[model samples]
Target: MTVEVFALGGYGEAGGRNMTAVRVDEEIVIFDCGMSLDKILIFEKDFQKATTRELRKVNAIPDDSPLKPHRSKVVAAVLSHGHLDHIGAASKILFRYQCNIFGTDFTVELVKSDLKGEERYRSETEDIKISMYAVEPGDEVQISSKLRLEFIPISHSIPGTVLPVLHTPYGAIVYACDFKFDDHQLLGYKPDYKRLKELGKEGVLLLIPESLRVKEEMKTPSEAVAREMVKDTLQFAEEESEGIIVTTFSSHIERIQTIADTAERLGRNVMLVGRSMGKYARIAEELGLLNLPPGSRVYDKPETVARGLHRANKEKEDWLLIVTGHQGEPGAVLPRIADDELPYKLTENDSIVFSSSTIPSPLNKAQMYSLDTKLRMKGVKMFKDVHVSGHAGREDHRLLLRMLQPEYILPAHGDADMLSAYAEFASQEGYEINKDVFVTFEGTKVTIPL
Candidate 1:
């Protein structure tokens, strides 16, 4: 049997447009069709209204032309998690493949929600109907005669993240994209170390792991530590702050819960404001993944958000405002508020806490700088980087390598420097460059001998 791996996108980029495909004897399975947020921001294009051609032209979405010839051999597309960097381009690209989509429960729900916004776009073309299945962690499904897929629970910033393993005739191929060894996560499932050891013992032919943060010297801190940081930050805001506004990733339900629960303890009502805040939090609550305190509310509609902000302005001490735009993206809640487009006004006595780290990209850096300048001009107290990362760091990656001793290693989910760094680390672990440890770019394919 011949086993080949395709790096369609996200090979030389950091958390942007992640897509990979594996082929075993003419049958193929694709993983992660994501989009680049930096490209979207730099081009200022509406993601929903942008056509596939336009997105590809701007380098926003994965250019799948490399797979056009083998599209017929594709049997399934599997999503790792609900993050946009992992599953954002589903509505725009997955229609080209004649296959079912598979993801964990929350990941599937988030995708279905995103598809609703593409109703008009879908109607403009041939029927863009696709089947999606929700599988729980530890569940295995037969994809074809020679391929079986399994979902191994893993911890990350978002819920429903997993390490997808494809069992083939040669050996098992593990896709370890965007995960951390988080044991004390406040909300999501913990990493299944036992299962990973089992896979390592069973013999893994190839291991594809995310390279982001692999250069950091220490293990990534647990979400529970972040919970403490948030709690301490918000608790200190209770005495003197008139308005407390915390901004973070809308998809980070655990951080949201931490902020909400802390606000409740401070005798404040939680007000989640933003289109994405409502979309992710509401679904998480409905699915029993989040338990928001009673009397806490989500405001996404223009009218409702205006009313909510107006109310907060009147009684700023009574509300804890959770907003989007942690990366300072234009039109998101926190950025709009900094620009005075929202109803609530910032004051010298107010505090704005950022529970998210700035995503390391040029567009994001400039936008965040502008937003911080605006907020600083208003004299609001700003708190930054009050959180931890969700990707495995150097030591964590070392642990993963020790656990899964695969014959071949492909470092992904990072830029050129980061991938090279991972390759160097692998070399320290006795793997050779361009041989056992392969560094690939987007649109390139690596063939592993069976």
Candidate 2:
């Protein structure tokens, strides 16, 4: 038996570009189909000049033939989680291959929301049928004669991120992407330590782990810290202020839930704005993962939200406005409001809270500084960094390494420097440079023969 792995997208860097395939005998199993942040910012620069078709080509599969050859033999597209960096390309690639998609319940809902608009676009162009298999953590799905997949729940900012354990003929390969070890998780149950130790005892042959936070020395903080920050900022605001705006990542369902809870405590009528925010919230609530208060509203239409904010500003003392553009993305609702593009205006004591850290990208930094200047000019009270990362840090990575004890370690989902740091850590644990530890880039394939 022989198993071959290919990094179709996310290898050297992070964001929109991520595609990985494992070929075992005649069957092909895909891990993720997503785009990179690099690709999105490039396309955004010349929005009017570039079409979706063109952007798709820039991030297309390296060679369509390898995927097409065994397209019929493809058993499943197993998603590690619901993050766009992991599942965003489903709308573009689902039509190309005929396979069942397996993911956690919340991950499936999040994917459905992402593809909703794309489905309409595809329907206008061609006939497509996308079926989603929603499985919970610990549920096992046999894809082919030699492949068994299971989802092991992990603590992340999102509700249903999983560490995929693929039981192949040669050995089990665990794909650990985009996860953190939060012993003090605020919303859901804690990480399944017993299951993880059980898998560790079973003996993993290959461990593909995320290296996004490997450079950081400390373990990522828990979601509870973010809740405290939110509480402090909200309490600091004027007692009679009407507008209280908070912005964060749209996929952060836990943070959104916490925000909603805080709003209820503060006697505020919660309002969720932004296209993606409303879509994800509704899906999360439908799955019974999120429960909004009786009268909370979610609005996607900008004009309607503007009018509602105007009315709420006049009468309500506690009106929570949850929005997008936490990184100051141009034209996002928060930036638009800061620029006075919205009908409502920020008063002296109105609060604007950023429940997120500025991603370290240059473009994000510049846009955030520009937005801060604008909001400052309007005398808006801005609170920042009321958030914690969802990625495991250096100490978390060390713990995972000690638990798994895989034969081979491959650092993934990070740039060369970050991956290199991870590789160095493995060396300290006595892993050989090339024989036991492998660092690769996109288009590179690693093979194990049996």
- On TM-score, the candidate that comes out on top is 1
How big is the positional error of residue 260 in model 1, measured in Å on the Cα after superposition? Answer: 0.2
RMSD over all Cα atoms, model 2: 2.6
How do the predictions measure up, each by TM-score?
0.98, 0.92
Predicted candidate 1 versus true structure: per-residue lDDT over 94-187, tens digit per residue:
9789898999999999988888887876556566768999999999999888889999999999999989999998889999998999989867
RMSD of each: 1.0, 2.6
lDDT of 1: 0.91
Residues 78-142 of candidate 2 have per-residue lDDT tens digits of 88887777877676676567788988888787777666665544446555677789987889988
Q: Compute the lDDT for candidate 2.
A: 0.78
Angstrom error at residue 166, model 1: 0.5
Error of 1 at 369 (Å): 1.0
Q: Tell me which residue pairs clash in candidate 2.
A: 9-19, 10-18, 15-35, 15-36, 15-37, 16-35, 16-36, 16-37, 17-35, 17-36
Score candidate 1 by TM-score against the native.
0.98
